[model samples]
Target chain A: MSNARRIIVINPNSTPEVTSAMRDALDDRFLCLDIPEGPATIVTDRDVAEAGPRVAALAAAQEAPLAVIVACFSDPGVAETRAAVPCPVIGIQEAGVAAALALAPRFGIIALSELPIARHRVRLERMGMLERLADEVGLSGVSAYAAGHDPAVYDELLAAGRRLIASGAGAIVLGCGGFGPRRAVLQAALGVPIVDPVLAAAGVALSVTGGQR
Target chain B: MSNARRIIVINPNSTPEVTSAMRDALDDRFLCLDIPEGPATIVTDRDVAEAGPRVAALAAAQEAPLAVIVACFSDPGVAETRAAVPCPVIGIQEAGVAAALALAPRFGIIALSELPIARHRVRLERMGMLERLADEVGLSGVSAYAAGHDPAVYDELLAAGRRLIASGAGAIVLGCGGFGPRRAVLQAALGVPIVDPVLAAAGVALSVTGGQR
Candidate 1:
């Protein structure tokens, strides 16, 4: 029997491509796991409203001490997960925002869409970083999850980062899971800290959860 | 023998006036126990550098799963107290930032001194609200642990809030323990959402600690 503790990373979306990308990005970071990796559940419902409770239920059913990561950029189920779990539970939005602040005095969030960008701005305000923000810019026509499997998704994200920096952003936050797979590439291209909310979120999950696996 | 859980709010400064002010402010909020009130502790250390760990050791000595609030504006021993207790440990800085974000899209922090203001800005960055700030203004020469008793201190704080609002702040955050004694007065004076970091921090400790009291 392997001794590695199980850690669950929940992708609050129905998309397999996004989940696959997240798995690949995080897999190398956990090479020391002695056992098979835990399940990565993708919510079939693309609806944001239903995502929280479903993910929370999944966490509740897993009988033992389990560290859970809500992989969505919106951090669906994060508050409920914290209330339900005995161990540490983290939301990507929470972890990502916290980590970005650690690296840069200010950061600009680059959301997948204009509508969500406003919502994200509210979210940041709720978190109390409004002054820390130089600005928040949205990618006008693209949504990370809606991009399907097109390689052009990556290019759009890279372009968005450049635009935010041009507007005087000290750091670029990859505001969605679809961008998780391209962190290093975008960071190199942007010449500034490209905050893959996923990586930062996951790193914090590891710290708070003490998830050795 | 009271079944109610006892929570100690340690002001971390030896000012009875601040302690009484904090007590009066919280008088109606917490449930009336057998004691009918929360216990308060104040640090005798008038010195800054010696305060942090000294207060931590005091919090470490409690026998029960007691919730302790390091009431100092600087949150002198919060991290060390968390290390010493299995229950929830909260810092006023962390709680205030988190709570203020819950209410407003942006808030300005009014601190005592420029050095302490820098420290608070760092804390907000750590809390992920660096970007949500409208401003961080300091009272010309007020000190966190020593300013609570002086009426002139309130004048400086009020001035700071005015300047913050002039710079486009939608809310105000009182960023020190010495300022806790004046939360209500400041809140009314500013006519904005004035977040008293002490109360915000205490509420978080209560939520996470699952206080039986």
Candidate 2:
């Protein structure tokens, strides 16, 4: 396959573990790039602001693949990256919500912490989809790092998922990219469609580019 | 390019004018197929019900292209077609709605007539997205046939688009495939995102299959 057909997924944060998890979820369908200079995890507005330029710069420096997926739920620098790159640039947050809308009408989010819930609310508000949102449940203090290594976080997610379902969400979206690996388990337990944003981005990229590789 | 990578867009209704309009909209990106035996237009539940098997059978008999887009906004036989085919099958309504959700929070539909509004409402309700709909405006008496031949139909569509915007729709979806050719004009005039479902289906198909021909 030509390099032009390749899809590049960039993790704005410097977490190799999260990058690896994303790569595993994609199963070698695309190239996965991690920014080693970014914070270990983006948990605050400051972290997101700091990572935005790095993500846009990295995307700008690439050789223009078929599509670029900014693999963060906050969609760090997505607009800037789109301005920087010639190919389509997809934000995982937007892709996840889009995928959820395709499968069902109302969707709920399971976030890593209260910070993302607030951030997500702002993002949804800007998109004019806050009305479509059923509920957003957060793990309170759970960090992506702890969630990845901790099995107990799944229970918390399940509890949150139940609450979202109770609130009338027909589908659930994992609000953080680090929650990618736990998607299948949560979907099975919750008995509803669970959207993994990275996968959703990959799907969108494949559809837009028409590159089967 | 392999034939397997080709995308076939099937118009469930047997309207050559609508099919030609769809082909023009796509600019020959995919193979456009029209069902010779289907109704002239899918307006009523009976028309949709009658077209289902034909669409499914046509889809099933194809040589398994990378993806298939059922070009009708009503998405008559999408599920049956999916069951019959191994590759991805996209419904224009689903694709359009998904694309709309990606760009904006709430979407308004500009339908061919009042008949499709009820059908669309039921479909949206089934998807669990009825609440996300800002409104659906119909060009009361405008048929696909009349819309294609008459430049005057654009006035009705423009009026409907403005009504949707006034009703707080952040985006507008051209509810019929025949409206495909008018997308740019409407978007320019309305100053909001307008989703042409056929193009949306093509985009979704390309993303899912990764086959750019």
Candidate 3:
């Protein structure tokens, strides 16, 4: 059992590499948890649907932390998790989008795959922020596991970022939790504010937790 | 001279009441500075324009703090202040809008007067978030300085909030710094999320300062 001040960051996927990368990107004080029962990567709506309940259950079972961060960019079961917990439950996707909006008028997303783009669109539409999206560009060959291990994916990310800028994005949002560590590098390469969803979630979680860990 | 980790929160208006309200709302760790040369309240474009250079000058004169928060909702001289300082300079309006967007899709403003509504519209348009606005409801007889002392303003705020919700706002943003203390109360009364611009600026400032202050 973690202390009451600990923040639980839940990565809703089975890939340990992705979870490890997220933990590295987050503040050292937080407790990072990954759902072992989830799919290796959430590439489709079916994967999201399947992972949702498991993530929510894990979130509900945790003793009260300062807050809970749903580390996946799709924000698996965030509303359900929030209803089950007394403390704040923030979705990385929501935090990222909010950060991007603060930095720029229009924001574009660099997504891991074509399937997640549709899911991202639905979330934005539900938030009534579809109009603020310049575009969402996906790299077809990327997966959360491969994104950490492969140097080639950076090139794909760069290319997608350029296309998003060309499409009129004033800022860029890395649309996957695995992209957290690459935020500073991508922002420098792209010459725009780049929001990493995991970090954004941590920022919001920390704010809600009264600036404590 | 303040310490390097100190954050300077500037209430551009000259009113001591509004400034005191802002200081109380902010984290105790910050150093709040009030611009005594400006008008009593910034209710119009003329007032914002008048206060801009004074606010910018005050911001420029500060020895580098961790960050600077322009506490006025109109965010007078934010761009100029950012250019003048090496550290981050955040505006309450931008922070409030971002926080509202993070919590909900469509956000409405409870503004002080009709004059600020037009200025707020311009800022929203510049951010390309005009479409995300459900509406900007104003309290005809209210001023920032008066809002704190008058218990009657709460009724007007409630009316404005209900109208904003009727107009399709999923969340409410308090467009004046003086309304900061009433956020939780208003949220409970309105049955929705309420974003207080001053606290929102503090949250963003803390995030930009790497959560140190």
Per-residue C-alpha lDDT of model 3 across residues A1-213, encoded as one tens digit per residue = 334467788989888988888767656557889988888878778888877788788878877666688888898888887677766677888878877766556789988887688879988887666788999998875878776567798889889999999999977888888886566677667776677777766765654444322
lDDT scores for all predictions?
0.59, 0.76, 0.77
What is the C-alpha lDDT profile of model 1 across A1-213, one tens digit per residue? 135555567776665667766666664332211111222322223345577787788777765543576777776677787677765565666555554443345567776666566666666666656666766666655545443345777777777777777777766666776676566666656666565666654543332222212
The local lDDT score (0 to 100) that residue A164 gets in candidate 1 is 71
- Candidate 3 chain A, which ten residues in sequence have the lowest lDDT sum? A204-213
Models sorted by TM-score, best on top = 3, 2, 1
Better of 2 and 3 by TM-score: 3
Q: What would you estimate as the lDDT of candidate 2? A: 0.76
lDDT of 3 by residue, B147-207 (tens): 6667788888889999999999877888888786577677768876677777766765654
lDDT for each residue of candidate 2 in B152-206, tens digit (9 for 90 to 100): 9988988999999999887777888777667767666777767777776665565
Candidates' TM-scores?
0.49, 0.64, 0.78
Clashing pairs in 3: none
Off by over 4 Å in 3: A1-8, A16-32, A59-68, A79-89, A145-169, A185-191, A205-213, B1-8, B16-32, B57-68, B79-89, B125-135, B145-169, B188-191, B205-213
Best by lDDT: 3
